[model samples]
Target chain A: MIASTSIHIERTTTPKAKPPQDKLGFGIYFTDHMFIMNYTADEGWHQSRIVPYQPITLDPAAKVFHYGQTVFEGLKAYKTADGRVQVFRPDANMRRMNLSNDRMSMPEIPTDLVLDAIKGLTHIDQDWIPDGEGNSLYIRPFIIATEALLGVQPSQAYTFMIIMSPVGAYYPEGINPVKIFVESHYVRAMIGGVGEAKTAGNYAAGLKAQDAAKEQGYTQVLWLDGAEHKYIEEVGSMNVFFKIDGTVYTPSLNGSILDGITRNSVIQLLRHWQVPVVERQLSIEEIYEAGKNGKLEEAFGTGTAAVISPVGELNWLGVKLVINGGATGGLSEKLYNNLTGIQYGKLEDEFNWMVEVK
Target chain B: MIASTSIHIERTTTPKAKPPQDKLGFGIYFTDHMFIMNYTADEGWHQSRIVPYQPITLDPAAKVFHYGQTVFEGLKAYKTADGRVQVFRPDANMRRMNLSNDRMSMPEIPTDLVLDAIKGLTHIDQDWIPDGEGNSLYIRPFIIATEALLGVQPSQAYTFMIIMSPVGAYYPEGINPVKIFVESHYVRAMIGGVGEAKTAGNYAAGLKAQDAAKEQGYTQVLWLDGAEHKYIEEVGSMNVFFKIDGTVYTPSLNGSILDGITRNSVIQLLRHWQVPVVERQLSIEEIYEAGKNGKLEEAFGTGTAAVISPVGELNWLGVKLVINGGATGGLSEKLYNNLTGIQYGKLEDEFNWMVEVK
Candidate 1:
């Protein structure tokens, strides 16, 4: 593991002008500086630096281009009301990224050192953190295999990088409800696959289904399990939850769904509010039945990008299951408010999830 | 669709010396020039050019590095005995790559134009083709999403490139048998997944399982179905076939296995030779039962890299099922010879599979 003190910094000689506040869409504009580190079999990890944000030059035969040997983590840095900047649960992301690395057969990174680098980079480009409501600096940490070999085995060299983008809210509507389409055709990930890992292929595999959902006038696709299309797994890139009969239910880890940071935080928040929250195999048919019996109260998705996206309707097999009368539920609103409050330093730090950067 | 006449050529001025024939390994050394074509929604696929081989420069937020919205194809150019270069089934690879683009929600490329580009590139770099019993020029055609956006959608911009490498035999011990490990715990791709697509993530998902198999002293992994883990899917990156009771059998294309070009060629050769061939669901238990009854005579894998790799032993759940006394079977050898002969222009072009480059 490399130490944070060993990281070298090189400021940009020509920094581009920042985009307008309204133009800060998700992942559209980047900061002036980016963090990078290299890993090789002989030297382990070295050459950690903060260089000018620029294009990555790689051999055409790099494994990352052909083998998809990569993993990524997404989090956000929020600006407090008093002009302080903080990141929410950076350690949790680092830990989960390591698990993803193990699943993807890549080397595990030094989480603490990477965390310090993240903070240092954020602090250096602290002005890029958007200040308006429902806005934050989206941070992306990723690792790619750089070995120029065509063999299917893991690459001998790797590159880890952190790139920050100032973005507005994930949904321009802001906490409103969106319709979801239950996808029974295209599969995302399998039980013994890289679904739990935040890798590239899982996202690529879902594009066709998402495109179909969009064609059907839905905001996202609610994915069923790959093995059996009966069980619910996730909604787009987010973990899903349903409130039924005054109790909340979410799909368990189950070796497929991602162990999302916002999902965990929402579950803890539900438990703290004395609300019953269960992690089990929640089927799409069961949710449909609950809606028919008027027991399905609310539904929402949890992810780093959106934070919380309320599900107003689920269209499965040409049948619509409307939840909370197509509006954001009370509990969903409260959870979003609380989570975002803690993230932006508006609420008290009960879980100590915020890491402040001076 | 762009035509071959629109292609602009830029030769490399700094041509490097080629590697020695003994050092000619798979995907190691590259030619001086490469084919590149860009795709955008407004422009379609324009700006086709052959330029100097160089590193690909991409923004850190390119979707290829993050979401794996990419596909690739592999084929080989062989220097024939008559001093002419030829390719085997480039059309099939191009068609399959188009299907992969459809599955990944990418814009469909003009296969005819791309085929012309491949031939033109091969023609220009014909000298790099190594002339030996088991040596040729390996060509890799790949497409990467070049849009520098973090959103998980189909990229608006893409780059299609063809890079060539002179290679030696896949196995130093030519036409030999390898030990295979049946993987039950790790699933490759589900029926409704992107299993049939020659995409980057599919290869990434198999690295861990391959590593585990290698740790157990196996050369490759025999993948099982994701739904039930009962039916055979693929052997490593190749398609598998078994000769049992004087009949050839292969797992059917059940939407979960690659439509291998060599597998097609092998089946055609068997049919032309008046041999029985069947493509249906094959169970591991059936293979084991056949092995026990001394009915499993020969087994082999087919792919572009190895052409034909005979399987001498299969280890399934602590049970070793050895085939043909742990030696290469007669049928496996005949098929390999026939395939290589046709590919190298030694055998008669009965099937019209060879495409000669001027």
Candidate 2:
């Protein structure tokens, strides 16, 4: 282990690291150490630390509770075959996080600082990067308004923190298809809003709809544009993808759907594979028609947690469109295989997306 | 002092055996005690408390950190001229808060329970209520997700808290004028979104645009609808009012505008004054043209804290519409005086709006 024998190491104290194999669940288990930083209007971003995971006490009147002034990002670290804990395209996550911060009126986190924090935390939790397919350490970085002042005029104080959680495979027994309930009444995002930003409010807005969808025996809810409820947007927490006519197509990231890291990676991989891809306004009617006409071969949702969750059937307005018979679609299967292969260092790192941690 | 000398009522102590006889400022100070309750999926809402003012410790991964799972209501307590602590139109705030709770998928605080909690806290903080015109104890009741889970699901745990702050009069020196900034780019709320709900996300989403407006010396950002920027929605947190000719015109209570308690109260008072109050789409262009034609007379925004904030000038795209001097308009002064009169018990509580506590 790289210890404080190196320079620039500030207050390094190692804890007894646990094996990465056993995970309580995705967000349930956290690593030993985390990166923290505070930002005040007076002090740009002071008090940076990689401290042990702990609870944060807040004034009951903190603006975040009353104003929803918070944003976050999710990505993961993979345990490669050669005992290397690697992060996939953290730069994209960092950039998107800043986008979320800017949209939410929160201070921007510098790219270098985001990189440094994640690298530092993952290094400290290297043992927490579990091995095997579908197992990894889920890294969550978030920011919140910490001002004690009750009056809301852009909080003068804020806190940014990065916490890591060990996650089991999203699907324990290899990849499989999941059903989705299309939400037409409850819109996920609207034009000129923070739809592209990974803010908590957006997610909170989706919960009730998601709960209803889940109650209808669907694993997730597919969100539609608020303006035109017919336009396809995204799944519960991931970006939607479709494979049609030997080509890959996903909804355009038009200021509403999250610019997910895994979504970007999938597009890049599809481009690398020489498949024609289109990112345009995908409509629900088009998908329903494609499925009915046997042209919609596969559908999936992509994000850091579930690398690619295949959609077998879509329940929309009481109409069911089965993309696959609750089994992983062929193209989805290939995409998942290729993405996981690159993540686990089994395939060549052609794009050099993985960053190695000592 | 009604307190526990054992179980129910032994009259333990009182901070001060009398209420303050001065007008209060806006959200600058608070009552001595507050009420809180918790909710989890396994155990619905439990552990309700009427605790002293204190900070709450939260997990870093709480859903409130990432998803804007938060909402709030604002009302006030007034010490009447007869030394009675009363609240004006409080059920409106409670009902509106429940509407917000439903929009965000949060468990609704029972109406009677809300009354009990508000009564409990106000009784404990009776001394904080101000007994003068435009001066009242501002009460902020808010709910937030507290589940430590990282994934986006309606937080398994939630917090319902009520914190009171002694607010000085919104217009300290009596009715003053506010300048509004018209933005064509950023839209605050959208149709089918949480615009009707008093969710923190709505305010958090608007801070940047609001800050930009303030930087340009504008008091608040006048939001337009997301679908078409032509229609006027609201000015910051308050519901806006416009006057053309002798009839008062306010934007229709579309789902994109908050269902403000003060907005409703103002509507009733306007009707009481025999003024025509039309709730229809009032575009910014219409307001500008009307001002040019000498048809637009006055404009203002209403809320529980601010009560009635007059608009003297509207700065739109380098064109200034000086409807009135940077002072209170005629209609505004009347609304402010009458509304606050009923609040602090200066005027007879006509409409039976005020509920006396002790």
lDDT of each: 0.93, 0.81
Which portions of model 1 show Cα errors greater than 4 Å? Answer: A1-5, A171-173, B1-5
- Native interface contact recovery, all models: 0.91, 0.83
How well is each residue in A141-193 modelled by candidate 2, as lDDT tens digits?
A: 98899886667687878888898888888888788888899988877787778
Query: For model 1, what is the alpha-carbon lDDT of residue A121?
Result: 95
DockQ of each: 0.90, 0.69
Candidate 1's clash total is 0
Off by over 4 Å in 2: A1-23, A324-327, B1-25, B130-133, B324-327
| B268: Cα error in model 2, Å | 1.5
Error of 1 at B206 (Å): 0.4
The alpha-carbon deviation from the true structure for residue A253 of candidate 2, after best TM-score superposition, in angstroms, is 2.3
lDDT of 2 at B331: 90
TM-score of chain A of 2: 0.94
